[model samples]
Target: MLKTSTTNVVPEKKVEAKQRQGFRLNANDKYYASIFLGPSLLVLTLFVFYPMLKTLYISLFLTNTLGNTTVFTGLDNYVKLISSPDFLSSMSVTLLYVVAVTVLTVSVGLLLANLASQKLPGIGIFRTLYSVTMGVSVAVAAIFWLFIFNPSTGFFALMSGWLNLPVVNWLTSPTNAMWAVIITTVWMNLGFTFLILLGAIQSVPSTLYEAADVEGASSRYQFFKITIPMISPTLFFVSTITIIGAFKSFGLIDLITKGGPTNATNMLVYRIYKDAFYSGNYAKSSTEAIILTVIIAFFTLIQFKFLEKKVNY
Candidate 1:
């Protein structure tokens, strides 16, 4: 009996091993997987990771016009960037621009989203109108806004003449140029924000609103308590994207102000571009680029940590 039991168990173990072998990836499976994933990996390495690593490497040495490292400065490039008054001013302006754009874009987007979510006549038309700007490219939008902000032929100019009001230099004045950028950016970004928040708002169960209505909750109270909390995840996403976009704003500044009126509109990205391409200071530009990357990463991490706690999901 013992001999029979042992023989039976060996056969069962062999069968189980065969079953497990069937689940393992065969040669064909791995070949197909590689075929699908290889190109994407190659592209990412070539474009993203390689450039980042190269930038980090270049930040350590002063390079000549031909992109050859002439002197090993180590962290001296970073030190100088931090100490330079122009760099410091660019950082300050970048901070202000990021904050202004992020807040305005996200808030206005949520507002428009709330309005679009409402059940009303021609709401789809309104939604389409709001989202139309999303189809416009950044460069196109910047140029279009440039036409609008033109002191001679733009909307403001025409309005000022019609109303007999003083014509303000939208793109020229140091104090008002940043606002001009903000306004154009807000309009361009509103469509995306609206669509995202609108989807989030719509996903919220109407039963929650019904319950609130049964409890005599006011509209403002429902908005603050129900709408805000329920859509906090989408809000966080829009805010993060907006912040990053604001930091990397180049085409708008280039077309609208070109960091003019005494560098009032010069953000970090524009400054980096100017340093690298125009001024031929690759090391300094690389340092500034790395610094900007760190700043963006820090802010993103902070958002995920602090803002995430409030998110319902």
Candidate 2:
């Protein structure tokens, strides 16, 4: 019936043009699709892309603090950072923190994820409790760790007494403040990695495990050789996020130490904040900001260029 109607009314040119315009959404369809997707694209453009471009532009200028003038400095900001001891020191601390956070978070998260993936009794409760850390705010988590590490009157003293270890000033001392930051960051961030890894572990095919059993492959070997490789993508994703987050770690430092003890834990992000907001040195802050952006950009590009490689399932 439709074929007869089309043969009756349609011209050859009209039919040919309709064929050329195949697969496009009609107006109503486009309207609904836009309703679904428009908001998200708007948000991405406004919050992510807009600020990124602005930051890149601001990074090119030299600002005067008192007079409130921004002059074009070109790459002079980056040049100063390369020659500055303070910037280099902060970068070193940031690098160490990123390494520590990634390793500890991934390790602890994988261990908990493996345990929680089991069919053991009361596993659901344990997994939920383990994941609660992910819900805690960064400042809240750092404050919680402070209470846990109070040398004179906290859990560390009680634990130290039980284990006969020395009570340490976990926050006040330069030696332990950075370590405390790393430990707390690890504890708080591990839940995200755990959730990702839990899914990966559960997704491993039962048939593979059965085949491993038939071949007499030990559980340890099967996990190391098969499960680890199968879950490597999740691990890689979490590692990348962890590194980026650790590099931009200002909240913990601000809430916990404020980069205290004579700049013992002055990370790049903290230095940028201090220079911009606290010290009123907008020019230097812009320089530091540019450096931070470059570091983030470099790592993200590396992830995309090489480390972002996908595994065939």
Candidate 3:
């Protein structure tokens, strides 16, 4: 009886050992996965997440110019930003640019994408040429446009006979500067809009077009009833990206206009830069920065809440 009981216990002990070893292997695998994932996640948290949270952290305080100490004041900075005329003006200009850029980019992109979707001759070449703008950096594009639209020493000067108009200062003039910024932004940003829309157009089902053809539906009618509905998600995404970009626009403004002519073209980002570096008001700069963040957050939330649901249609 003693010998039989010992033999039975040996098998049970072996089973327990095997189960413990299997659990150890699983834990080791999980530990390795975490180790491999650590670098990228740490970088993202430090560079991206940390800075964003830091901005919110700084927005509640006043930095002493002489003492270099930060003083907390709750929402006082926000209140000051709201009442300031410069802030109001900058906000208005920023909004205008965002709206105008979104409209122009989305409309032109959809039009180009629809045209390019057809089996037209030389489309491959045209698409490549049109997408060249995407490769051009914003600073370079702005400089190129400045040269192209130059009144006295540019391409416009050489082709003076085409239109009977005065040679205007493109960058210095407040009215023309704003318009110039818009034009440059549209040209540079159109490629992205086109690329996104093209992808969306391709994702649309061929069966729908075939069905429309079988029913003898006109091309215009099919596009309106089918293509538009299918590609709305793409449009919304591109619009949101474009608007956010317009708000964060500083390279072109800095390179092209320098926020001159009584700060006519000085949008919010420009104002923030100026306040921080040029005007030597770090506290106000932080306040303006937070205002910008809030504006973008509000708009983005609105878009996700309302427009996101309509994407499937």
Which candidate should be chosen as best, given lDDT against the real structure? 1
Q: After superposition, how far is residue 168 of candidate 2 from its true place, in Å?
A: 1.1
lDDT of 3 at 51: 69
**Model 1 C-alpha lDDT per residue in residues 1-313, reported as the tens digit of each score:** 5445546567788676556665564656888989999999999999999999999999999899877788898999999989999889889988898898989898888888888898999999999999988988878888888887899999889999999999999888987899988888888898889999999999999999999999999988999999999998778888888888888899888888898778999999998899899989889899999998997898689777866676553
Off by over 4 Å in 2: 1-50, 161-164, 301-313
Give the per-residue lDDT digits (tens) of candidate 3, residues 216-253. Answer: 99999998999999887777788888888899999998
Question: Which stretch of 10 consecutive residues in model 3 shows the poorest summed lDDT?
Answer: 1-10
Q: Residue 145 of candidate 3: its Cα lDDT?
A: 90
State candidate 1's TM-score.
0.87
Give the per-residue lDDT digits (tens) of candidate 2, residues 71-116. 8888887888778887787778788888988999999999999889
Cα lDDT for residue 86, model 2? 74
State, as a TM-score between 0 and 1, how close model 2 is to the true structure: 0.82
Q: 74, model 3: CA deviation in Å?
A: 1.2
The better-scoring model by TM-score among 1 and 3 is 1
* Candidate 3's TM-score: 0.83
The model with the greatest TM-score is 1
What's the lDDT of the predicted structure labeled candidate 3?
A: 0.82
Error of 3 at 198 (Å): 1.5
